[model samples]
Target: MAFAVSILRLAISTAVFPIFLLHFLGLWDWICKKLFPHFMVQFSKSYNKEMAAKKQELFGNLHEFAGSSGKLALMEVGCGTGANFKFYPPGCRITCIDPNPNFEQFLIESIAESRHLQFERFVVASGEDMHQIADNSMDVVVCTLVLCSVQNQEKVIQEVHRVLRPGGAFYFLEHVAAEPSTWNFFWQQVLRPSWFLMFDGCDLTKESWKPLEKANFSKLKLQHLQAPLSWKIVRPHILGYAMK
Candidate 1:
């Protein structure tokens, strides 16, 4: 019966909640990679050339940027597994930050292989707190599927604004809450509590579009870009950019 299944789900989530709390404290990503390296690897493997090509097309068009020749600096907050590595401009410097202990090593190793692009850094820092870097120090700030887990999304937006120069841009791809329907809403409410446990601090339903709009930035450009905007939806990601 539906009631029995709901009870079973609740019981499972109740058991997993504590561990999730620790994950929010930045523990689960490490454990998932350690306990299930292949799973994590498989996840990364699927993030293939096509996704990178799409990202390149979108961001490159948004910023009118294609490749790097001079000394330009790029940074990605919450850079998971460094999938954005390929998109890094040749002959440019890149920095990535993520709190996942399991990812830090892999990120460094993976990105360092790019002969044309230099790995400037990859630190374990919260996206909201990039105060250590000087203001207006970056040419571009990139974020992809990263907003869901951040505890203070507002602060992160502020930090992005702070870090970019006046003409600089913040390019992003984010999944968010969708329009309500009967069955989709029903299951999202039911499974989100349990499902969030497995994702690296992802939220099934997040209103992530507002922060960038409200931030102190000029020339905002957004696309309501989540595929399957209504049906069988999980990662209804909003992807776009804002000029700072």
Candidate 2:
């Protein structure tokens, strides 16, 4: 029995060693970044169509909140491939932020395609610590499909609030934990470890809306719904805006 156990351990170690080596060499993150943009294209098309009305309501009148420049100063944290750029109203001066610098090329392509938006710059920074952005500077903050992968959701929310001007709005769309006692939730739990490993730290079971709820926004409008054309594990989603 002991010999059998040792053999099983060896098999498992051998199977995992390549993954460990990729991570150690920083190639795993690079691979995920390269592939994720392509993978998200179809998902974004479906999600954007389904969520169009809500996004319109959230962003259509953003010019009303514009400062002296007649443009909304918008910042999107974890702005992978700028999937939400097409949703913003015209004349938005947009700054994009993401921890993975590898997404920069894709982001530039997205910016080029989003000609109506004025690209401010892309900052390679994490949402949890956006010290490069000044406090009370942004007119609007946006995050989509980001909270699940952030190392510290609460800290990210805090940073969002800190950077936004008083009365500035924070918009978000994120997949969250499915209801307890459901098959999807069970699978979410079972697959979470491998999902995290394969998808660049996305926790399949994160209750990402809790931190948003507790963030003490002046006004909050959140809706829980199922994401259309999404994987079963990521179907439970939240979409809304909070005013700072």
Candidate 3:
């Protein structure tokens, strides 16, 4: 059984590295737009429903936060291939930051050429330092699947808190370590070294949740979900909203 598990892991890793390379090369755009927007949109739509429901549940308690002033100043930390561009609400001003300048250039060029756009504005830099966004001014900050690769998660979380207005919301999608999964635990431990070095220091099992809870968010709306076929090894995600 152990030998079989090892072989399976090797096979998975071999297949996984190519996908990582595509992400590193920022080629998800070509794949999503040319080859797979249909599948991508469907998956995102499914997640959006669940995420929106999570947000709506606490609308009453979070009126001040959820109630935007009809104008949104948004930021996407680690924007990747700008996948979240399709998720933005109209009229929201956007600024996205990513360490990979090459990727950022690609994102800007894509937006310039593309027909459909959901973001209001876009920028390329480190999200940990939103030196451009004024303090207590932004309406919403979209941080989907970003915290994992950040070197200083605490610093960035603090920065997010600092930039948000008194009632602004920071909506996030994150993957953290899973519970009670022995094989998953092993994979995280075994691959910790290579995963980080190869993928901008993104550890599959990094704990980015506790600090967010401890942050200045007045109300936190959080949910966890596991992906279908991760061998129950890779942590799936938690989509949540926190208000300043």
| Best by the lDDT measure | 2
For candidate 2, list the clashing residue pairs, or say none: none
For 21-79, candidate 2 gives per-residue lDDT tens digits of 78879888778777777766666777788777767766666676677777899999999
Count of residue pairs whose backbone atoms collide, per candidate: 1, 0, 1
Q: Choose 1 or 2, whichever is better by TM-score.
A: 2
1-244: candidate 1 lDDT, tens digit per residue = 4685588668878788877687779887667656543455555556444355557766564325322445668888988777766666666677787766567766766776777777887777889788776798888889887898788899999998898877888988876776676555456666676666676556767788888788888888887754532335554667778888
TM-score of 2: 0.85
Q: In the order shown, what is each candidate's alpha-carbon RMSD?
A: 4.2, 4.7, 6.3
Q: Name the candidate that leads on TM-score.
A: 2
Which 10-residue window in model 2 sums to the lowest lDDT? 1-10
Question: What's the TM-score of each model vs. the native?
Answer: 0.81, 0.85, 0.69
Between prediction 2 and prediction 3, the one with superior TM-score is 2
- Evaluate model 3: give its lDDT: 0.63
